[model samples]
Target: MADILFQHEPLIRLGAFAGAFAAMALWELASPRRRQAIGRSVRWPGNLGVVVLDSLLVRLLFPTAAVGVALLAERHDWGLFAALSAPTWLAVVASVILLDLAIYLQHVMFHAVPALWRLHRMHHADLEFDTTTGVRFHPVEILLSMLLKLAAVAALGAPPVAVLVFEVVLNASSLFNHGNVRIPAGLDRALRWLVVTPDMHRVHHSVVPRETNSNFGFNLPWWDRLFGTYRAQPEAGHDAMTIGIEQFRDPRELRLDRMLLQPWRSDAGRYPIGRREPGG
Candidate 1:
């Protein structure tokens, strides 16, 4: 199973991404949670462009990707799980959970560190939140994230199948949690206990710095709650809350070129986690 998954990793990931993106797009059109001031025409081109660039760059830089690293680790019996002689089922489950936690920590670090925030802030800089917003990360940030995942896979001796599952599920959850579509309040409340809901994740994109610092989890909801970074809702409420950061309020920043240039263009601004004013 691991060999088959390793051989077909790209196709499996592409199919999953396409299916999830299409589903979320349709759902957004059908029942949007909030009215979009900016249409997809302006955002999708740049947002989608970033995903293409990030994917191509990852393939170019890390041909084997995380699954390949996992396979190598497994072959050599490397890392904690291998050393422990853990059962396959336990290893897979624990690896997935730990990988998710790593991502959660990475997200928080991006906000807390001034330099990293410069790269990650691009994702939060989207003027509108939607499924495309989920994929709108700066290329540098994506590369750094891939490097981290590779290290984590090797260190954990994560099974190739588990790495593949984590990659696919993380992609799907990013799209799902960033969806502009509405869920019934009751359903959203129930769903967030198991996974991060769109409403829960959207708070992280709120213009307010403190709100921006909260709800950093992309795949699992537990880490935010565990670390006490969870915010139930934007203070201004989701419908009325401003999106994007203070520096790039101009819609021109939505262009592909501008997004690529964002990290270099401005100072990290006041959004870096510890920059809050005394009263704030």
Candidate 2:
């Protein structure tokens, strides 16, 4: 039962795939003009495929290293994995939060390293903010992130159940931030203190390079808020802010081939990718 549940958890989140689709479709209807201009341009199915590929690869390879590290760390008390202490539900919740914290660090590394930035930029290349856009990542970035988390999982000796829960929440949050669904002002403001919401994430995708550098937290917004990278659009609407690389404002450059090669292009006029953020 645990195996079956873990296997499909990626397909079922708090906001399931179907739910995210409905939310996005609703946003598309409500804000037809703004969404249609860029949001409509994205290919949803292709992005979903990326998620499937990345998830499967990690799940298959992840267990070996994760289990190995847990075994190695068991020798030392502080380095050992957490034993199941609370109810199953509580353990899972704790796992998800811990894993999200780990993700925050890995995200920062992607922006700080030039080589990694080249690949990670593919995620930022999307002009659209839709559910499926979350899965749009350079293959290299996905592999590196998986490895980083593997080490974290080992060092912390996180429980298996928690790991399972963490993967589901991580996948869901990825979709949440990238999705185009509208967030109500009051709730959005409140949620920002906990998880990284669509509003917080929208800033990370801004066309302006400076604003894009802030808000690197994955599942939690406080990571950014605490780290001092959090920035929200002031006095106005995310409605006015645009998504995509600063130089690659052109929608065509958002395609897979162009985004994959974005770093190589010397001309920001042609590509529009920006310099790395200070202390990124």
Candidate 3:
């Protein structure tokens, strides 16, 4: 199974990514939930450009990435599960869940730590929220996330197949939850019980600091609920609430070049974990 997965890993991930991206793009256009502040022409090029840059950066820095690391660990009988002689199926399920929890905690860390938030806020700084917004993470954050995932895989002795499944599903879920497609309210509520639906994640992208800190889960919705960070809806209706952060509202700053320099150019302390009281 591992050999087959390794042989087809690239194709599998590429297909899932392309398929999810296209579907979300089309759906967002067909039934967008919010009126876009910045048009697709302005937003997509920069967002997708960052994705390209992130891909190149990750490939250059870590040729193997998380799945590759998992394969190696499996071969050497490394990590916790391997040492404990856990069942293959059990290890796979446990790894995927634990990895998801790790990501949820990592996201909270990014928001709480000012320096890390500088990189993460780029994702929140987009003037509009949509599918492309999901892939707009700064390259630095991408590299850091990869290192974290690789470490988790090594520590847990995650099955290679589980790591592959997590990567592909996480990518797809990020796209799904970040999309602008208008899902039915009833359906959105139902979906959030199991996964982070578009509505659930849109709250996290809200300009309001409190909303921005909530709903940090990218794939699973349970973590936020369990951790008491879950928010049902944006205080302002999804269509009414502003997206992006309080600062960097200038359209000129939305360009790819400006976005790359954002962390250094902007103050890291503007947005933090708690709500900012008015009348400052």
By lDDT, the best candidate is 1
lDDT of 3 by residue, 96-132 (tens): 9999999999999999888899999999999888999
Backbone-clash count (model 2): 4
Model 2 TM-score, all chains together: 0.76
Candidate 3 local lDDT, residue 116: 91
Cα RMSD to the true fold for all candidates: 0.7, 4.8, 1.4
Please list the residue runs of candidate 1 whose C-alpha ends up more than 4 Å from where it truly belongs after superposition.
none
Q: Please list the C-alpha lDDT of all candidates, in the order they appear.
A: 0.94, 0.65, 0.91
Candidate 1, residues 20-130, lDDT tens digits: the string is: 999999999999999999999999999999999999999999999999999999999998999999999999999999999999998988999999999999999999999
Question: In candidate 3, which residue ranges exceed 4 Å CA deviation?
Answer: 274-280
- Residue 111 lDDT, candidate 3, scale 0-100: 95
Ranking by TM-score: 1, 3, 2
Give the lowest summed-lDDT range of ten residues in model 2: 266-275
State TM-scores per candidate.
0.99, 0.76, 0.96
